[model samples]
Target: MSGVGGDDEHIWRLAVQKDGKIVAAGHVATAAGGEDFAVARYLPDGRLDRSFNSSGSLPGTVVTDIEGGRDQLRDITLGTRGRIVAAGSATLPAVRGGTSFTVARYLRDGSLDPSFGSGEPRPGVVVTPMAANDDLDLAESVVIDRHDRILAGGSADADGRFDLALARYRPDGSLDRRFGDAGKVLANVGPGSTDEDLAGLALQPDGRILAGGSTAATEFAVDGDFLLARFRDDGTLDRGFGRGGFVITRTAPGEADDEIFDIALQMPNRLVAAGECDQPATGRDVCLARYLVSP
Candidate 1:
């Protein structure tokens, strides 16, 4: 389940089964340079799985942060052979504005797998870029397909507003060019001033793609609405999604604001979104609901 604390110090991440059962949960409670550090384990029933971590904490490792301290885990994907991979950002000192795509892998026992990239030395172990760019780029969502292909959705800053970014990687951590340009692609949904984001993503049973985020209404302000886009396997928007490939949602009446923090696709083509909505003087409430793909 996707959970965020009101304190703003932590965005709890939990892995749950298809049947509404939570398998693991974790969060980063400190601002250790804003790095993504969290711990989690399987749940036997509704409690923590003692087999992984009795105390419920796992300290991740990093080989290099060419970008310094802005590392964070925005999403996680189960890896082949029973492993977990989290994707987010790594802050590279101010010299570069602390922005870099970052990923980390952990073994089934919740231990940092020394066999992955920059991991422990093994025979013929190779590593490559999952998805990287010069300017500000981040991985906000990730998942492993039935074939074990690593799919990710995120945002990349452009001249001003941000654009949707998608990429796929081989199980070995190498970029898959068959998906997009050098294994990466970008999309601009609306004519916004200085803001855009790819917040959550999910893969359909047939291999189609669904992406969600928001587009700024203005350049100097946060007057924007949430956006959801569906894409074909070729990196093109699926026109049948919302309207010409996308849909936008916002808080009714506009007394406050609404933002979609996460999204999940249910059976057929229905979608579920979870987020927080500011109810003016009432403060913010945890908002959760589902949407249908209108014809």
Candidate 2:
């Protein structure tokens, strides 16, 4: 599907339906402009979904935005009722804003859902910039809880500093006030002179939440480390896990940068964290680490 509209495509994350169907998501070029989130559904036989958004979506039903700026979908998962939920950042073209953490929901039929967002930027999109006036709010991961609540985590910038941010939303697409102050919590995971960027998130069987990513300084600095933390269901840090609810480990002692881009639960209390690390011999090596659940 390459065309003059800059058909460059990069798929970041995807989900498989219970029926064996697959849905791939990422950002697609915009002719001579920026990129908008591109989502494609495929049949089990590896055929494109010809019945999805046939004529209403655009560019072969690959677009999901309303009618403004460019957006990106970094992580995605299947929600209840077979809804497709994606998360990333958006450059609000309507307000000419820089970028804000965004979450969008789509029906199983590949059309935008009308229950998300507050009707500002659109109807099916959820735009949460942390402050709406902040510099940037970007989401790196998204997941659905046992109760079907939507949870997204990343970094939120304020005072020129970045902090770990996690927000919980009800199935109806409304903020769950019972959560961290209206369904949002921001934690300063970097104690030193650095910022923490949450890249991965996992839900424990006990309803607790686990997050993994990187913590380091910006501005051409190369001394970053991997960060992992555990949180209770109420959004509070799990003090029993690590030193003050978080742990920072480095894959490379004093080399470039290291981070846990993704994490998964092995059983009850065990977790597997995987990402790229700077290796002294091979330059970049695939790093994997295992952690006890109680730790």
Candidate 3:
């Protein structure tokens, strides 16, 4: 489901069958709230999941319409026992910066899982920003690990720069400190660059990690470049993956102008990266390339 309308509109997180068929989808539009938006669900085969919110809709009470805040769902992943986990952000007066990262879990039947995170299906996991300036911190991606742990990735600016921040949570919605400091890790990437940020992340079946984003020299817009880093399950840099667990993809001949928005893994340690490349000659095109992990 997707919200269609204005700046506060959002789409519903969907579930698909193993055969690549969309079983259910629904969205809560801003029009339903006058100025705020809500979440909805759909059933298998592109129909509304009526089981959700009595005809497929659920409004958030934490961020009320009177709070001058907006709520939106970002990504969703299915969990064990028919549980669903979703990541998003909501602005609230109670929070230090008026916004906080939200994660919620739902039962297979589309009901909020009271067993998770204070009975809030959304943000079954929660990680508030460290400072007031971090009102925009949000979780962009989420995945489950072998141990039933949940991993989340996004950007934050508590220290200074907009660096990549990662968090891990137990299935019960508690933080996982074994992965990073208080279940969170941050990487600046480009110390002197204008804007350093992480875009996407993936976990290798073998317990390795890959994160992709952009980097620049001196400033974010002066000359951008693609950046990828690989880490071990213990959160240590994977020296064998790239140059010290890092790969910088830039325009051929070193003009230094490109950005990576997504990445995927192929068999036998082969990887495919997709994004945009501001090549000197090609100007810019949908960038796609393959790379083999170095021996």
**Better-scoring candidate (TM-score), 2 or 3:** 2
| Model 3: per-residue Cα lDDT over 167-238, one tens digit each | 777777787778767776766664443456566677778777777777765433346677787777776677
**Candidate 2: tens digits of C-alpha lDDT, residues 73-140:** 79999987888999888876434436777888888777788877656557778777563464777888
Best by TM-score: 2
> Which parts of model 3 are misplaced by more than 4 Å?
1-8, 12-15, 18-44, 55-68, 94-98, 119-125, 130-135, 158-160, 191-194, 218-222, 252-257, 280-283
Candidate 2 regions off by >4 Å?
A: 1-5, 57-60, 93-97, 118-121, 217-221
Model 1 over residues 1-295: C-alpha lDDT tens digits?
Answer: 1222112334446665443434332333333443343445545465544555332332222222223354556677666666767677655544443365555666665556664544313311222222234467777887777778777778777765577888776666667778778777888776444466777888787777878776655531255566778888777788887778878777534635566778888875688877766666676677776778533
* lDDT for position 203 in model 3: 72
lDDT top scorer: 2
Name the lDDT of candidate 2. Answer: 0.78
Candidate ranking under TM-score, highest first, comes to 2, 3, 1
What lDDT score belongs to each candidate, Candidate 1 first?
A: 0.60, 0.78, 0.60
